[model samples]
Target: MRNRLVAGALCGTLAVAGFTGCGIPERSEVRVDGRRQPATESGAVNAWRKEPPPRSMSGTDPEEFVRNFLSAAAGEPDRAYYRVKQFIAQEDDHRLQEKQGSEVELTVVRLVDKPVITPDIDSTRVTIAVQQVGVLRTDGKLAPPVSTDTRYEFGLRSASPAGSVDDGAGFYVIDPPNVLLLSDVALRDYYESQTIYFWNSERTRLVPDLRYLPLTVPNERRLNEVVKWLVGGPSDWLRPGVVGLPDRTELINNATGGNGRWEVNLDMSGDDRTRADQLLTQIAWSLPEFDGQLELKVRNNSVLTEDLGERRSARALYQGLDAPVRYCVYEGSIHPLGIAGESPGAVPLDPGANRNVVSAGFTRADKQVFAALVTASAGRQRLSVGTGPAPVTTFTKGPEHTAIGRPVWLRATDPHQPQGLVVADGRLYRFDQNARMSQIVLNLPPGSVTAVAASLDGRRIALIAGGALYVAALNLDGGTVAVGPPRRVATSLTSLSAVDWGDEERLIVAGAAGRPAIYEISVDGALQTPLKDDTGARVTHLTAFPTNPATKLPSGAFMYEANNVSYRSSPVERIQREQVLDVTPPPTGVRPGSPSAPFFLF
Candidate 1:
C-alpha cells in the first residue's frame, strides 16, 4: 500500500506501467508468438513484447548446431524449455520434461575455453570446460557456486532418418547434461532484479532482500510472481538476520488492479492477529509500485485484523536516513566539502590545542556534536565526543598505539541523545548521548574487526573482520546493545579494506578479487556490480550517501580517499581526481597538504 515510487519503480511509463525491477532498461520486445506486431493498427489492448524465443539454426554443421543449441537453452524460459528440443534427438527430447520450473534454477558458468569435440563412428562428443559462476535460484537471486569444480560434457549424433524429414535437419544432441546450463550473459538478459522486503530479527524494522523475477513473466502475472516469492521467504544468505511472512501464508488469488493502483489479498489464517501490522508493513515496503491498498483475510471470511484490515500508502512507514551532507577534517577543524566554488565555513568543534586528529564523524541530534579519534601520545590514540568548541569528552583509549577506526554515528531518533560506534584495541563499543560507552559483543574471533559502518536506519551494521566482509543485525532492545550472529558476505572479495551502505540492499565496498577496485555488492551477495575506478591506488576508505528513494538519485556527493588524496564522485559527475583540498586558514609548517578521509554525516 505504497504510493511513492522508491528506489526501483517501473521503467519508461513509471505511473502507468508496472514495476520493471532494476534501473536497467528493458530489452526490445517481441510478441509471444515470436513476431512483431504491425505498428499501423489501433487496438483497445496494448500489444505485449518479450525477448524472442531462441530457435535452432538450420543446415548448420553439427559443431555449429551444438553451439546454437547451447545458446537456445539459455534464452527466454519457454514451457519446459521446449524451444531447445528442436536441436535435441526426438527420443532424448523428453529429458527436459523433468527440468520444468528449473529454467531459472539452471547453473550459470563462464566458458573457460572452446568446446572440444571428439568424433566417433556414429556420434560426436562435446566436452566444455567451464568455471561455475553461480545458480539462478529465482530470476533475480543468483546463489553463489556450490562448489569450485563445475564442468560438463554432452553427446551429439547426426539426426535420425525420422528427424531428417523435418526442414533443414541438423545434428541432434544425444544424451545432454541432466541439468540446464546457461551463460552469465543469458542470466543477465532474461532476469529482472527485484528487491523483497523482510523484517529484522527483532521485528522492529524491514530489511531489503534483493531477488530476481524473470522478464519472461507476462505483465499480468508479474505481480503474482513477486507476491508469491515474497510469501515463500527471503534468500538463504539473508535469512540469518531477517524474517519473512508467517509459515504457510498463501496468496488467495492473483493480485488485481490497474491504472497504477493494485490490491493484494493474502490468506493468513494461521498467523497471529497481533503480528498483522508487522506483516502488512513488510508487504507495503516490498511493493512500492503497487500504489493502492492491501487486505489480509482468514479462511472463514473474516479479516485478520479486526481494527487494522485496510492499509493505505505506507511510504513513510519504514524510512532510513535521507539525503546526507559531506564534511572533511582538515588541520584539526571540520569543513563542509566543496568540489568547486567557495567552501562552506568550518564546524567549530575546537579539537583542543596541540591535538592531532586521526579520523572523525559528525551528527545532528538536539545540537551538533562531533566525534574523533585523535593521537593521545607518540604511539597511542583516544576517542572523544563534544559539542561546538566545548571541552571534548574522551571515551576510550588504545594501548600500544593500536590504530583506532573512525567513529560512525548510529541513527538516533531522539534529538537530545545521539549514539556513535567506534573500534579500538580490536573491540567494538557504542557511545550514547550521555557519553556512556558499552561494548557490542560479536560472535567472531577477538580482535578481528578492522572497520565498521552502521546502516542509515541504524538496525544493521556492516563490518570487516579478518579481512572478510560480514553484516549483522543490530538490536537495541531495552537500551542494551545486542548484535545478532554476523553473516559473512561478498566472499568473492579476498580482501576488504572499507565498506559503506549504498542503499538498504546494496553496499559500496572497496576490496580486491584479482585487481583492486570498488564494487557495489548486494547485501545478500547474489550480485556484484563494479563501479568505474581506474585509479591504481588501493582504496583505503569510502564514504557514501545512501541513495534517495524519491528521485532514485543520491542526495549528496560520494567521496573516497586513496594514496592520501581525496576524490569526489556522484551521479552528476563521473569518478574524477580532485585537487588537494585547501585547508581553512591554511595549516603552517610543513603540514600534509592532501586532504584524507572525507565523509558524509549520516
Candidate 2:
C-alpha cells in the first residue's frame, strides 16, 4: 500500500507541474499535504476542480519581439528608437540600467523571445525569454562588439487577487557557453565584415599621382608634359601633324661668328619644285629674327644646255663667301630694253608721242615743275644727258645706272600746260620747244633739296632741305614762293631720300635718322604722327602704286627699300603707311579744269 501511495504522489506532482515536450509526462497527481493521491476518478475530479486557468504571459507581442530583435542588431538608441518605436510600447514599470559617476547608462535595445507562464490553484510562475541588447562605455578605444544569441530570464507576480499583473521585470545577458559576446578576434572580424565592408562599398576607386615617381616607374606624367609632347615643344621644333601634308623641309643660310658666311643653292627641276622653294623662302624671310636675305635667280636650262654641251634645266644658284661686302643677285626672265641715247637739241616736229624726254642745257615750261635729280659731286651743273656708248640720262651720283636701277615714274598736270623739272640744287628748268636746252624759269634756294613731290593739282610742292620740310606754292605765272616757315619734322634726320604725295594736302617722306620711319606732314605746316614707330633700319626710298578705282585697292605694286633690301609691299601695308600722312581729300574739287581734274577720280 505504501508503494502505491508514493507512485500516486509522483503522478499528482506531474499533473500540477505540467508536461514539458522534452520527454516529460503531461500531468501529475498529488494529495493536498504532499502525500500521494490514488489515481481514482474521484481524486482526479477534486484535483481538477482545485486548479486555476493559465495566466497570460506579459510582453508577448510578436511586433515587440521583432522590434527588439532589430534594435539590438542596429546597436544605437536613436537609430533603434526611430526604427522600432512605431511597432512596440514598453510597459509602465520597464526600467533601463543606470550608472553612477563615469559609468554609461544602458537601455533595453531589444528583446528576442516569447514569454511562457505556468499556473496552479494558489500560485503561478512566469518565464520571460529574451535577448537583451546593451551598450558599455569604451572611452572610444574601440566599438563594442555586437552581442548575438543572448538570452534573458525573468519572473512576474500578480498584483491583486483579481490576477491583474502588478509588475513585469527582468535582468538579462547572454549565458556563458551559449552566449556570443564580442571576442577580440570576433570583434575584429566583425568590424572588417560589417562596418568596414559596408562603408567602403559606396566609395569611388582610387587614382595615383605619378609626377614624383621614380624614373623606373611606368605611368602617365603630369598633364602639362603630355600636352607639350602632343603639341610642338615651346621652341616650335616639331611641325603639326596632318595627313597628306608635305614633310617639313628647312633651307638654312647660316652665317656664324663675325664674318662666317654660307649660301644655300636650290635647284628646281620642275614647276612644282620652284613653287615649293618660293613658298619656303617667303616664310623664312618673313620671320623677324632670321636676319638673312634671299635671292632668286631663274635661268633656262634648255637654252644654256643647247648653247653649251648638255641641256641645262632651270636651276637656282647661291654664291656665298666671307667678305666685307655681300651681294644677292635676283635675275628674272624679262630684260629691260634700253633706248640707246638722249637726243639733244632735237625736237619732234609734232611732239610725236614723246611722253618722256631729257635735256642737258636750259629748258622751258608753260607751268610749274617739281623734279628730283642726282647731282654731280664736283660741279653745280646737273647732267640730264648721258655721254657714252650706252648713253642714258645721269641724275643721281650715288650708284651707276643698271638695268635694275632704271627709274620710271609718273608726271601729270595739265596736258595743255605741262609742269617742267626742278633740280636738286633748287633750280627750276623748263622744257624748251627745241629740246636742246632747258630755260631757267627761276633760281631759288641753293641748299640741297633731296626730294620734291607736288600736290595733285600742282599748286603745292613739298621739299626737304637738311632734314627739314618746306612747303611752297606755285603761282599761275609759274613763279614759286615759300608757303610756310621751314618746319623741323625730325632733328636727327641725316638724309631725305624720297617723297610721295599721299594726297593733295600731305606728303609721305622717308629718310634716315637713328632708324628709318615714314612720316606724314600737312602742306600747311602741320606734323602728323609717324607711320610705323620704328622700322629698325634705314629706309632708302618709298613709292605708291596705282590702284583699282572701283575697289580702291592697289592694282600694282608699291615698293620700299629698307636695310638695303627692296620689298614689294601689299596694298594693305601701303594704306597703313598712308594713315601716317593724315591727308584727306576735300569733298569738293580741289583741282578744277586740270588734267588731274578730280584728283582722286578713279
Candidate 3:
C-alpha cells in the first residue's frame, strides 16, 4: 500500500472500483495512525494535514536524496517547488525555477516495483518502473494514462568536486524527469479528494466533478484551485456529460476567503446577465463544502443586486432529490431499512398482490413508484412497475433460465414520470415514461451485459459485460433515448460481477483478478482505489448513494451482497461496509432468504 502498487500489479489489470466525490462518501473507511477514519477531510471532518518531507540533508548519498526528493514532491506544490528543487543539481534547479505550471501535469501515483539505482564511475541513475494509474493535471483533473508501463530515469552527479560519489556519499540529480513521482502512501497522505459542481446538459441541476487538492496547502490556495478548475471546465471524461462556465470565463482574481465568507471575481464582463444567474448557481454548488457567504463580481460589477447569503447551500438550490429512506425487496413486499422510530413493516406498491418480487428498484419524485423483477416461476422472471394501490403493470418477461439484474431507476427527464433500465441476459432495456419497455442497442465489447447502473442525473451509465466494465454517455433527446459510443474502461479488472454509481464520478464495482474484491473507480476509467472489506465471497450486489449535499453525508444506506449474504453500512459509520447482522437480524430487515438486490429509494 505504501508504494501505491499499480492495481494490475496487486490485483491484476486495472479493474477499477471505489467511490469518490465531495458530497459522496468513499466505499471504505481509511485507517490512519491505527484508527479508522472518514475517507475525506473536507467539510466538518477533523483537520489534519500530512507533514511535508524535510529538506535534503547535507552530504546525503544520491539514493537518499532521490528518495527524499520524491517524498517532498508529493506534498503541496511549494512556491517554485523549492523543497524538491534542493535535491536537484545546481544546473537543473534553474530549469525548474523558470518553468511555469501548465493546465495539466502528470503525477505518478504507483510504482510497479522498487526503483533500480545503478551507480557508475561518473554518474548514478535511478530508474523507476510504474504501471500507469492516472495523470494528475495542474487544473486538478485526473486523466487516464495513455500508456501502462512508464519509466523514469533520474541521472545523478556528485555534488563534490570529484564529479561522482563513488563511495555513495555525495550526489545530486543532474537530470530530473518532468513528472513528479509519488508512492501511493504519499498520495493518500498528501492529497484530499474534493468535488466541484458543473451544470448538467439541461442546466437544470449541478453535477458533481471530483478533484484532489493538497491537504497541506492553505485553504485559500485549495479554494482558488477548485475555482480555477471549475472555470477551466470538467475533466476530459466528464466534459461530454456536463456543461461548464462560458468559454474564456477565467477567474480574474484568486479566490480569497477566511473563516467563512469568500469572494470570486471573473472576467466575464462581455457576458449577459442571463449567464450570470447560471454562473452563480455553479459557483454556489461547487463550493458548498467551503461553507460560507459568496460574493461574485464580474469585472468588479455585481452579478445580482439581491443578497445571496442564504443561497450558498447546494441542497437549497437542488431540493427534494435526496432519498429519505432506503428500501429492500424481500418475498413479495418492500420494506424500509434502517429507518429509526418506525416499524419495520412492508410497504405495498400493489395491494393484495403476491407478485413474489425477488429484486426491485424504486424512484420517489412527485410520486412514489417502483419497478420490480418478479419471479413468475422457477427459471422465469417478469418485470413490473406500479404505485401505491395501483395495479402493477407487467411490462416485460425474461427468457427462461437466463439472468436478469436489478433494475436501476434513471433520473426522469420529465417531472412526475419515472424511467428505469434493466439488463436481461445480454440485452439492455429501458422502461419509458408511459411504462413502455424498449431495448437500447449497444456496441459494447464482445460480452453480455450482466449488470448495469446509471448515474442519478441520467447523464451516464456503467455496465458489466463479458467479465469487463464499460461506460457510455446517456443522451435523452425529447422522448427518444440514445446511448453514446461505449468505451471499455478498467481493463485491469479481469472479471466483473456487479457495478453501480457511487456518485456522479465514481463507480462501486465488485469482481477480481485473483480474488473477489470491491473497488472504487472514477468514471473516466482512471484512479482505482480498492474498498477495504473482509468479505471473501464474490460480491453479487452493490447499493450505493451519492452524498446528499444537504446532509454532507451519504444520501441513504450503502449495502452490498456476496453469495447471497447481505452487508450494510450505517449512517453512523458513514460509508464503512459492515455485515447487516449487526444492525438487524433475519425475518425482519435485509436478511432476505433468497437472492435479492437492495437499493435506496431514489
Candidate 4:
C-alpha cells in the first residue's frame, strides 16, 4: 500500500532507532550513468572541463568537513552515496555503495554534540559520537534510543602551513568515506514504512512485518515495489514459522491496477509450478489495502483460480485465532465477551460472577474466565477460575501480594485451556490447570512494568516498563522460556497507558506522553500514524480491534471519562453511547481507572 494509507506512519514519516558506528562496508565500483553529463555533438571534442561540484565544506577545518560530510550523505541513497564520496579520497569512492545495499535510504537521527578532532601525521582521528534515533540494524530490528558513540578515521592533507594560506585553502577529507557520520531531523521525512503479510502453515495468523522505504516512488512505482518486496519474502527475523514465496520466480513486467483491480504478471519458467495456488494466495492476502482484486498471470498467460473455488482474504486465514474470548475487568467481576463482542460488550456484569475478582481473563476454547481475586477488600489476592459465575475455583493463592494490573490470557491451540500471565509484587507469573504453583516468567524492579499485552501470534509480548513502551520477544515454553532485552517502541512516547496489537506488527497506543490523541504505532517503532478522526476527548481506554475481531476494519471505538461520567464513543462516526453494550456502569461508587474499565477482548 502507499505511504498515505499506512496506519502507523509515525510523524510525516515513521521512526528509526539507535546508532553506533561501524566501519563502512568495503568499496565497489560506482555506476556512472549517461545522465550524469549532458550529451554534446558526436565528433566535436569541445574545449570544456567539468566543473567541480559545490563543496559541502571547503577548508583545512576537519571538524566542519565532518559536519558537511553528514549533511551531504543524508539524502536519497544514491545521491547521498555520491555526495558523501566527494569528502573521501578518490581511492574509497565505492565504499558507501558497496557497504550499504544500493537500495537502502539512510535515516540518521543525530543526537551528538561538537566533534573532537585531533591531527595525527597525514591522518586526523575524528571521534564523532551521537545518540541516534531511527537507526536500522542488520538483524532487522530497530535500535533503542540511547547514546552509543564511535570514532571516524579521517585523513587530511595540506598545501601550506597555518600562516601560508587562507583557512579554506588547505584540504580536509573524511579519509575512507566509509565511516561517515550524520545527524539531522529531516532524514525521517523521506522515509515511510511498508508491510508484508505472511502466514503460518495452518494459515491461522497473518504476521505483519515492516520495511522502511523511500517515498521517492510514484503511485505506480510504489505498487510495483510493493509487489517486488512481497515476492522477495519476509525479513530474516520473522522468516521462521512463516511461509516463504515460491522460488525461481520474479516479476517480468510492472504491476498495473485500475478501479481497484490489479494485474500482476510474473516470469514462471524456473520451477515449482505446483505452488501456484500458494503464490496467488499470498497476493490475495496482500491486495486488500489497495481495495484490489488480483488477476495473476504467468509469463503473460492468465492462471485461472475459478476451478479451486475457495477464495480467502489474507485475514480470513487468521480469523478467530486471536479473538478476545472474554471481557476483561478492573473491578471484581468477569463477563464473557466471546469471539464476537455481541456475546456481551458492556460493563456492570449480570448475576453470574463473584464480587471479589479485581482483574480477569479467559480462553478462546470456552467461557471459563480466570482472574486475580481478593477474598475481601483487605485480603490476600489469589488466582481463581470461573465461568462468569459465583463460587469460582481457587487455583493459586499466594501471599499478600500486590497485583500490578489485569491478568492477560494467551490461548494456545493446544488441547489444554488458555494460558494466563500476571505480574504481582514485581514478579511475572504464569498459571495452568494442573499447576497451582506460580512460575515466574520475568522479574523487574518494583513498579517497572506499567502495562503488558501480547501479539496475536503468541510469540512476542509488549510491555510499558519504566514509563516507556517496548516489545520483547517471548518464549513461552513450560515457563523456563526467556524474555529477550526490550526494543523501545517509540523514543517519543514516555507515558503510555495501554497497548494492544492493532494488526500483527502495529499497535494502537493510548496516552502518547503528553497528547490526548491516539496513534497507530508499529511494534518495531518505525511507524506512528495518528488515528484520522480525533477521539473527541482525551482517549483513556482503547480496544485494539473492532467488535468483530475477524473484521479487517480498524477499531473506531474508545472509552473516555469526561464531566465525571464515562462514555464509549466512536469519533470516526461521531457516535457516543453512554452505556457500553450490556455491561452496566460501575455499581454506584466504585470507579475503575479507564485503563481498568475498558472491556478487554481475548
Per residue, candidate 4 scores C-alpha lDDT tens digits across 155-269 of 5655345456555654535345344344533333334445556664344455556654444434444456667777777654455445556676688778776544567788765
lDDT for each of the candidates?
A: 0.57, 0.27, 0.60, 0.48
Better of 3 and 4 by lDDT: 3
Which one wins by lDDT: 2 or 3?
A: 3
lDDT of 3 at 215: 62
Query: Could you give the C-alpha RMSD of every candidate to the true structure, in order shown?
Result: 7.7, 48.9, 7.1, 12.0
Ranking by TM-score: 3, 1, 4, 2
User: In terms of lDDT, which candidate is stronger, 1 or 2?
Assistant: 1
Candidate 1 clashes between residue pairs 3 or more apart in a chain or in different chains: 30-50, 140-212, 141-212, 366-415
- TM-score between model 2 and native: 0.26
lDDT of 3 by residue, 1-602 (tens): 11111232244232122222333443333332212222232344335655555644635555566556666665544342665676677788765533456733545555656779897777877898765666666665666665555777878777666644355345677777665555544544566656677776777766667676666665556557777888888766566667777778878778776556667788873555767777666666555444555667787776753223455643354456743445565445555554332223234354444356667776655544555454556767666655432234333444343556788877736655566788876788887544466888887656677888987767778888777777776666564567777666643455688888766566777787467876766665545656633347787788777544443444423577777656655322222223111233356455434324566664
* Tens-digit per-residue lDDT, 64-158, candidate 2: 33223222312221232222222222341123222333243222222223445455354333444433322322111121124443454322323
Q: TM per model?
A: 0.72, 0.26, 0.75, 0.58
lDDT per residue, candidate 1, 1-602, as tens digits? 11111221001111111111243322231111222121111122224433424334545466566556655555344443565666678788777654545344566665556778899877888888776666666444667666465567778776546435545555778787765676544444455456667776667556666665554555556556667777788766556556777778887877654444445577764545645667656655555544433454545353543111134233443344423445665555455555443234344444343247667776654445445454545777666565432334433443333667777887633435566787767677887644455777788865467788877667678888888778777666555556777766633555688888766666777776467766666565544555523435677777776653543322323567777767665321322223333344445774455566777654
Clashes per model (N, Cα, C within 3 A): 4, 23, 13, 16
- Write down the TM-score for model 3: 0.75
What's the lDDT of the predicted structure labeled candidate 4? 0.48
Best by lDDT: 3
